[model samples]
Target: MSQFLRSSSIHEILAFFGDLEKTRLQSISRMFYDKIIPSSLQQCFLSLLTKDKFFSYSKEQGDILYYYDIPTRTWIDVKAANHQEHYIYYSMSAVVTDLNRVLLIGGSFDPEFEQYTDAVYDWNQITNRIQPLSNVPFVSFDNGFFYYRGYVYIIEGHVDLFNQSTVRKTARFNVLGNYWQTLPSLNHANGKFNMCAFKNGFIYAFCEQMSSFYRLNSNLLGFERSTNWDLQYIQWERILIKPSVYFGFKMAVFGLNDNQILLFGGDDEFNNQITHSPISKEFSDANALKILDLTDLSLHKIVDDANQDLKIELPDMFYFNQLSEYNGKIYALGKDHIHIINLSKKEIEIIKDDGDYNEEDY
Candidate 1:
């Protein structure tokens, strides 16, 4: 097609679909579908942009997939549809598998969503499609997903007041049996301020109460608190700039081979914006990602030149949350894009296109 016709055709198609009915909508949607999508897909494609529940992850083939709105319609490289699935309210949560499958935990969005999520799916790495796995009684979102000890851990919670309490609930999923099992109550259940797991048989949690910090033993059936890193024993050093907000997201702790934990990006009690609700008084903006050496409690910023390279304005919104070490390079996933941190070269490169960075170089 010529440029003029191609441009005009899209405009005409948009206009036609703008006033389409359900039957016509599906027909037109199907015509545009380059791939087959099941009719069981509940959520529509356009609604995904509005909802934050969709999952985003990079595949083994170096393709970025956004499993959004509808299960059967997957977005490739954050663009239009490239693949599809047949599910709804799936935990946009993404985890890597030994064979390289993308595990997604989904749940019903009913009242149960706050208390329970009973669905899970595994997206095959070879075909770029998703299949149901097992279900959990606790919803995935209520408790964030963390992979440790060959199983995915789901933490549960309920918010009562705007900024006051985020009650901690708990559950675990067995990858082998595909079932949900309850765990002991969190020692500090005020609300999950932020949490991450380390390979060193421990999961660390910091709360919004500002009174306690916890180190949960990974081996214990229930998350048993390790009293060594509790609140009263914490040593605080003076900082020129205090991280004022929680960033409403979990702080990521990366475990290095040298028995050191890299603590990066967490909110101090001063910033309330980190909480899930803006209606609450505890909302503030945090944009800095700090690296704390667990060995000596030494602190440093991940990006030395924030203004020049990082360009981070909102510490809470656009910060590194997930770090994966593949092929000797560390790939950090931030809010907007992925950064390839060359620890060897002490440099950073933003991954915009799938073809831009060769996987072999990692």
Candidate 2:
């Protein structure tokens, strides 16, 4: 016995689709595709935004480094540096590693002291608090920090701030151990310096007299220099030049959202030969900050150029130093101005008031 079933013809199918409303047909097709196809393929059909994450940047209420959750858009002030007996300084600059570990390095909060930096604080995201370490690190600044070999390696620029002569070579704090270990001293007595981190474990130390780039090997002890990256700058009115010399010595070094590394305003000894003053006379009067792209090794200065749509007001006297990126936006803490740059929009927004810190009054 043969079984017979009604088979829909091509004409019937075309007639059914032609008779359906546009919206109804679209809805039906979507539903059918979603039900029939696997999620991996169906996901390709949907459009997605650029995934702009949002985060907040705020000074600590008392004296502590804070972490803001990008997903939930919430701030968690880690009160890890508060002193119960005597209120000590809580100065910090943090780096989030590959494993998502936040390492808030040492700095001074109190301005009364000349030279003194407390212990390095490690805040584990798993625990949501500051983690304790066995070894205590000596005082240092963000100028001496670079992430290498899954560890935060530190270069002790100046041991004594008052002395200004005591040179403490270099060291590293194992993010895993939370301990401090010293590395080999620099080639010379470089008490003040700035380091730029690059791809393939390359770290560039840019200073006044000398600038050198090195590759941090897997052992962490192995450091090989690539070439002598000479430091110099010529003030041009409107020409584009690559910045080989780092102007921002103590300021912020940022990898921009637009795939560029921004070196903000920093102080350094004068290298220009055009100065009429004594040869020994060191000048820090140059206020022009630089923005360099590592991809093509191209450099551009942050100026009042009509071509570039800068969103924030550039700092005047105060050196804009520290850089921190949150929620796809870059926030810069100058000596006076707190600048927030929206990378996606290519616009800059400035926050004038800094709580208690005064640049001019000081």
Candidate 3:
């Protein structure tokens, strides 16, 4: 048994345990499960063991909410129990807060309207019900959305479709108060940029088009000194180092730690010029996984053991891909597969979604 534990691959060990009785393998599985199972399997096992779930609601599937059951290898649709008003919102931003709810932010509700929406909704995970929350002061879509402390922040994004103009505006929604307040605007107008907040009280925003990076100190001391306790004063400062330019849509960015950020797959717009629009024929997906070191503003491409650039394929052309971190592993949810990324190991395991749950269903 000792030799089997050490010498056997995680998959092999799992297979061996599968043949044994539950009573015989339960304690053993608990003991070495973290090592005996692959990272993807570990995610599932941990989800079951901890009763913690990662919820996902795609813009393409605006009405339905789904969570992956890693152990069963299935996407379970927990029907929104109280979602009576079905409105299809596209290009929206979603953030899962610490309060076990998802806040869906600004998006275009209808293409015919040609107007962006400021509507916000809180979807309860436990009740599987969605309730309308406070709307944003400004209407926009394709914005940078994040949740920090007790507030939900939205950065620059497309504001007007007629002129194709973007905004540098920043705003935060107080979750507890259900009120929206505009914060200091960015120096440069940007849309489709990536933004994330760190526990260190700094919010980082990166625009690939302009090769610009900005950091805003959200702490009371940092804000008071910079703006004299004035919320309307400009607080965003352009960092000295800029991120490398990469043009794509629906790119995923998440902070790995206080000093590291991981950027994942997106639709490579330049490579697939024919499909420039979301409604185009064929979309090209960029697979490069890059990590930006916040300490030095150094961006490096992540590669596998073979010294080859690691890639993640985003199969869904219409929906924005979701990248989430749980239990130290990054989970990239594409249309067809879930890529379980073990950054520490520099390894990624792709698990194909169940065939029955296709895009057409949405």
Candidate 4:
């Protein structure tokens, strides 16, 4: 047995054990492996092993990548090996693949150059390397981006820098094939909207500028690689429900269930009046929470059983750029904090980054 354990390949050893035994042996192997490996390498390996973690990349913070450990309740910085190869990326979109890699999509690398990028990068969590993938067909920023199944979708966004004009274009990139395909365009042209995918294989997009809620049934699209699918036949159904005008560009929207979605926190316009300054009193509604019911097409604010309004405010540094979900909670990634939404409890817990660079209970 000892000779077999020492001589066999990792695949052979893994295949020989049952599921429960494999897990037990993995835990034991990690315990012994940690003693010999460097702390940096151990962090990278542990990140891949742990499933319940949130990876956050903020262009505002330059090339540093951070991840929140749900079990330990800490945010640790995972330094990139080739962070200096690219400049700071702003208004970019990121999605974690099934292979445990983070893919960063289109965004502007430098404001001075006014250059928007079509470049996509594949960031490996284990090797801590950021490598360039195929470039997107078009350059845009602040687009509605999300990952579903094995593909990443990029929705309408600003096409140019000076004019601030948006396009109705939408596209999807095959993660495994490393290729892009243009999908059907949206009915409206808008940027900075909230987008999410449901378990029923429908992609939902909500744009406050157009006051439009649209969804596409991906299952009917037949996007397999072998098929010569004509995208023009595909259509996005514009939902009839008119969302509140206050649900502005920065609001975070996430799926609650098959027939429900939860939206909160954004630049709120009070009385149909827009506030110009970022520091204006009515600039943001950080505590507003609403649930959209698709069954009856009703939009209503969520309240507790006592008929009391639930007041949960996002942290001051919270950015609604991208969100991740694990278990039953939705993790809203921010510049220095992560706001966790507990669906069952209707509560929000903040994981704040102290000056020491560690996330703690707030």
Candidate 5:
């Protein structure tokens, strides 16, 4: 209220206000919401104008929760109405939670990973429901959540399925106290990885038929009243590079700052072939866009002509699973559409599919 706009009795009531008295001062500022403003400063200014756009999950539908719109590039179904059934999207692990909700994690329903799932689904886009909070003391699958700074890092995945083994179990969720701490494991455990997060909270993991590139140290996520884990040194830095490509499953590496990194698509060996395909010019130097440089940790290749894999044209190369970027566009996703990309004038668009996606049966 800034003392009712610096009172001279509101400067003699804004000389009779205006715009219909600014719509009656916004209905008298909603009757001074909780008396002179204080609903946690309207949730701390709507979480500082939060802009995650959308990322809902939970096999969406079976337990309702869709969210993926970013300006009519649809996926709708914020049909909350409170739903939940162990948010199973197999081998579950989705994260967009810091209170902007949508958190499903750790899943498995018999692909013989031995009936896993330490359930923990959230959703709640204003009660378009899917709740069931704590229960993942352990259970893995292609894991990787890492929500940095506000803490939520799950990390470790690939838990034994005929030896895709890996278990230094990591899990440190605390989304404003929905508690689930314990994150200091993984000295190089294996199985489908990819955890990028950088600049000041470093994390650059790597898995899937491993080739070494671990790092994970940024005071190892400190929090004992502001960092001081015995003078900090939380480990994991196997960056002893060796092999070459194919990593962190269903591929698409991220982090474009703190010394670049951008990889894409998987399978330089996972079903044995089919990793680079802007339109299947096949392998095109392993998906023409691999950067990974952490200042000499080398792994370059940037094929000019704006990534000419036949001058880019991907409606669906399975959309390349995931490859974030935001605000400067890079998306990629799949199972329906979204190829956005822009990587600076090397354009690409393809966001179609308004038939309200529930697809994927091929």
Candidate 6:
């Protein structure tokens, strides 16, 4: 039936709804496209606020992922952690996979010393908890992590706190089987590296200290049809981008467009790699934005019109983390300011989270 059978009598419950709501419900749910009944008073109406403009803020609470609604401009809770013992560290790494799952691999709670980051967490959107999963075979802090084709690949760093050893180690966790397996290690050890999955079924990886772009094949078989993947033929081809040794600063890497990757705010100042203490906020300066062109394997620093050369207006107090992209805009989130960078137009709109970060401060 295209139209609702409306009755003017008070017994008709749906008459309470105006003509528009009735038509809307009819188009949304088939229940509204029915004849009016007198005794039936129970029905379900699905109603919710729009979330497209909401920005996800990964707050201090590791378990809970907060969303800042742009329209309301309020910090709202998206989800919270259910597990207690599992450490949701400020040092942790996470990825939102294709399975509609948000997963965190490892992190440490203590700032001075690393504590309990080997376990995996699956954030339940409904429960608002980080459900702990199987542990990796080893522990790490300065690792590179990314999700692709139903698996989480980890580039291991810092074998243990006591060992203090940095070596090329790689592994993968199968979400379907809930298991972890070691893969072939890289040619060199890396710290604070960026590993992002591309649409072309390859990973673009580089450590903060290297100028080479590593294109890696997970070598997993049957990944399209199964949760488990094969790692017998894993390989990495290092493509040298620049020979000047412009090290990668510690920052979050996000996908800009189909052909380029956006490397947002980072700093050259290195923190204690061993301790992983004194987070980026402690740094006195932030770095310029970089875009990695996939087609030519070239990294270009974005230059602002205000600056004469290749430098943008550096917000000294700004430190970007949890880089998130939405509607063709890359949001560089910090404690005090959110720098919304538009790549195509080369524009930046800085929204102060708490204190105002005026260009006069820089």
Over 1-362, each residue of candidate 3 has an lDDT whose tens digit, in order, gives: 86545534443333223212323544575558556544444443334334344455655555677776554557777677764344566555566553234676665355565555667787766587777787678765566777755577787655343454434777777665578777777756443554445535677775434345677877642312132346454377776434334535556676777788887545554343222123221223145677878777777788888898776654332133356666677776655667788888888888876522345533
In the predicted model 5, the residue pairs found to clash are 18-21, 80-128, 80-129, 81-128, 82-129, 83-129, 193-248
lDDT of each: 0.43, 0.43, 0.58, 0.59, 0.52, 0.52
Which pairs clash inside model 4? none
Q: Worst ten-residue run, lDDT, model 3?
A: 273-282
lDDT of 6 at 190: 41
- Among all windows of ten consecutive residues in candidate 1, which has the lowest summed lDDT? 353-362
- State the lDDT of candidate 5 residue by residue for 1-362, as single tens digits: 76744433433333233324434444565667447444533452343233334454535345555656554456765556754344335545455532244576655354334455666677655655666678777775556665654556666655454554444566666655567776666755444554444443566665544456676665646564332333246766676544455432355566766788776554343433222212222433344556678778887655557455322243233211345556777665654556666766766677664433344521
| TM-scores, each model vs. reference | 0.53, 0.54, 0.69, 0.71, 0.29, 0.65
What C-alpha lDDT, on a 0 to 100 scale, does residue 49 get in candidate 1? 18
* TM-score computed on alpha carbons, candidate 4: 0.71
**Winner on TM-score (1 vs 3):** 3
C-alpha lDDT (0 to 100) for residue 126 of candidate 3: 58
Q: What is the lDDT of candidate 4?
A: 0.59
- Which digits, one per residue and each the tens of the lDDT, describe model 6 over residues 199-287? 45566666554446576754443344343433345566777744423333445567766787766444454443424322332232235
Q: Give the TM-score of candidate 1.
A: 0.53
Q: Tens digit of lDDT per residue, candidate 2, span 296-335?
A: 5565666444554242345332222345566677766554
Cα RMSD (Å) per model? 17.5, 15.7, 12.1, 8.1, 22.0, 11.3
Runs off by more than 4 Å, candidate 1: 1-91, 106-118, 126-129, 140-142, 162-166, 189-194, 206-212, 222-251, 266-285, 296-321, 343-347, 351-362
On a 0 to 1 TM-score scale, where does candidate 6 land against the true structure? 0.65
